[model samples]
Target chain A: MKVITIVLQIGFLYVFYITGSLLQRLFHLPIPGSIIGLFLLFIVLLLKVFPATWIETGSAFLLDYLSLLFVPATTGVMNYFDLFAGHTIWLFIITMISTLIVMIFSGHTSRLLARYREKRREGTECQQSLSESSL
Target chain B: MSTVLIGIVFISLTVFIYLFMTRLYHRFYIPFLIPALTSTVAVVFLLIIMEVSYDTYMIGGQWIDALLGPAIVALAYPLYNQRHLLLKNLYPILGGVVVGSLTGIFSGLLLAQSLGFNEKLLFSLLPKSVTTPVAMQIADGVGGLPALSVLFVMTAGFTGVVVGPYILYWFRLDSPLAKGMAFGSASHAIGTAKAIEYGDYTTSVSSVAMTLSAIACSVFGSLVVLVFYA
Candidate 1:
């Protein structure tokens, strides 16, 4: 019974994926079918058409095994070995440099904005309390 | 052998090795060691030693590959769980991810282009900041190699795992929201894994950032391709 429920829940996810696949084909969207399916599932959840419990087991199962699913792609890296032979140094340099720059800039930018918002919220709260005290 | 039999045995071998390495990493608690890196290294070496062709390995590998789509679709569950937090911090999350993704895309592109890298390589590197599944999809959409893009994504994730925490520390950025967003947007899953070490709140926030970044990078990547490349 438990296994059957998990299977049915997974089936629910696939239904969304099929819808996404069909939408992608019909519309020629650049988005992947899976992503469109993700959006559809999100909207379905948001609307309370189905509660989280309905899919939690299957979702948890898939996510727990997420890294395992990616093993194939990592091995696919071997296919590009010849391509990297002449450009190994360049690939390494570009990947490291770009990654560093992105991490630093994004980290700084997000922290800066979050702080700014936080300070502004405090200010608004202080003003509200001041007004309330005066009243 | 039969191809089907080879595929079965090969997959079992890969999973066994991967699980073993994961346990080893957890037990040792090595600061820089990541299971994906170690497992990939181990599997590649084992395959080479065994003379198992990439074709044969993929015969089993493809079973894992097929799950990528549903896994991505399942991502929506996390996003849905965080809907309230997302609504509350909408502006900051949106602002941060947009800037972070643009930084990721442009920095990689300009650097590679300046180095005179070819178009295929440039496109592969373009989606390095997004999660692997979406990154691969974007790479294919933009006429790049999907496999290569996954490599770049992994590299970026590793980079984040190695350097991400130190950068946040040096800057004294203690906000959980900021830390999570930075890690998720810039490094994808690897960064999120690091964020998980921070605490539960950070993990939830990073999940939000990772999901949003994937969506942003995809939409933004296609637009760049449509407008600039085409």
Candidate 2:
């Protein structure tokens, strides 16, 4: 019974994916159907159209083995060895450098924004305390 | 081997290898020893040594591949769960992901171009920071090889997981939100897994950032492709 429930939940997730594909074709959107499905599911959840429990177990199971699902696609790189043959080192350097840059850029950007928000909150709290003391 | 037999053998082989690699990763706790990276290398090596062509391996591999779409859709659950936190810190998360996604796309393009990479390779590398499926889709739309884009995405993911922590510490990006944003925007899901070590809040924020970054990358990536390729 437990296995069947999980299977059915996964099947339910697939329904969203099919709907996304259909919408993509109908709208001629540039976005992928899977992504469209993701947005659709997110919206449905946000609106409380269905309880989260409906897909909880299924999503958990899939997220657990998410890395495993990537193996086949990653392995597809075998057929394209020629593309990386002469440029392996350059590719490595570029990816590493760009990744580092992005991490730092995004990290610092959020950190600064978070700090600013924290300071603003603290300032408001301080003002409220001051006003209360005066009263 | 018959088609059915090949599919069963390769699918089982991949599962077995992934399980073994997961065990190894848990034991060593090394950043580079991630199951995804190690198992993929192991499977590719096995296929090559057995004189098996990629097509035959894919015959079985496609079964697993078919699950990727739904798995991606399943990402919505985490994003949904984190809705409260996402709403509370909307500005920081949105600001960080937007900056990160644009930087990821443009920087990759500039670096690849500077290195004299060919047009096909350059476009393939454009979506490197996105999660695999979205990256592959964007790559295809932009005249790049989707398979090759996967390779670049894996590289970017591994690099982020391996190096991201040190950079975060070195720069004192100590906030949970900042750490999560950095990993998710720069490296996608692999980095999100790494974010688990930090704590639950970090993990939640990371998953949220990962999803938003994918959307942001898709938009920015498409625009870049259009401006240059069209």
Candidate 3:
């Protein structure tokens, strides 16, 4: 099962990679593979093709250690001290302002959409439960 | 014997300093950004002021660097857990990546170009808005150096961590899923790390979002390179 889990994850990531490549190759759209892989998994789950337990353990294991990914890049910053000396002001100013914009807009938009969906779901569930009780 | 002894001592000290700091980060500094962020900031300053070459500092930093690849492989969980919601909201998530990556890259590239930056600088800055690994690959894939990519990625991560929360709050981003997705989509893992600070659900969602964003940004970034620069 552990080996199965590893195989599944690698397989899924490749699926994401391939799907992302094909999307760009065929449609010239700006979509990414990870997102596509996510979607593929989403579809499989919704259709009951794969059970929840199948991916749960492996997925959790990955999240536990994900932060370590940035260490190499962060540590590598030691190499570019001069680069910063030249561009600290530019880098600081640009990174701060632009990242703020990206996060705020993206986060806000998704939240609003989620809100709409949650409300819709609750309303439907309420209606169903009420109808069943009445019958 | 003396040189080897010094090298061993130096290795131990780096390990001690990093572990101590990491413990502090996990404990006392739980709510705030990790000490690693401050350490990153401090190290950058030390390198320039001390006139120490980046390569010299990397000698010690390499101990920490070795863990990065496995961390990336670990991002499988959050994606796995949210498989159902991910399916339910697949279209929107896909739409989010498309709009987000394009807007980020074009605006970023155009601004740099308009500012009269050269191609080398442009290559470095182009991947600045994404996560570390994918950003490095995209940078290398386009004529930029990996060293430059790492620098840009840290800057982006720092920027994302500082700014992501305020934006979420101001926008009243109350959903864990959206919060995670936004952070993941924008900053990659660093942003997701911050999102995790908000709660478990936020962390998980943001992580999946981050991985997806990396995969998206890479493909889109490469395609852009091939189309225009190639």
Clashing pairs in 2: none
Better of 1 and 2 by TM-score: 2
- Mind giving the per-residue lDDT tens digits that candidate 1 earns over B78-153? 7787777767777777788888888888888888888888888888888988887678778988888888788788
User: Is 1 or 3 the stronger prediction by TM-score?
Assistant: 1
State candidate 2's TM-score.
0.91
TM-score per candidate, chains pooled: 0.87, 0.91, 0.69
Q: Which of 1 and 2 is ahead in DockQ?
A: 2
Q: Which run of 10 residues does model 1 chain A get worst, by summed lDDT?
A: A83-92
Please, what are the lDDT tens digits per residue for candidate 2 over residues B106-158? 88889889888888888888888988878887888888988877888888888
Error (Å) of candidate 2 at residue B21 is 0.8
**Which stretches of candidate 2 lie above 4 Å from their native place?**
B118-120, B140-147, B193-200, B222-230
lDDT of 2 by residue, A5-77 (tens): 7899899999999999899889987567887898899999989999999999998888788788888978877
List of chain B TM-scores, one per candidate: 0.81, 0.85, 0.78
lDDT string, candidate 3, B86-160, tens digits = 667665566566666666666666766767777776676667667665676678777777667667667667767
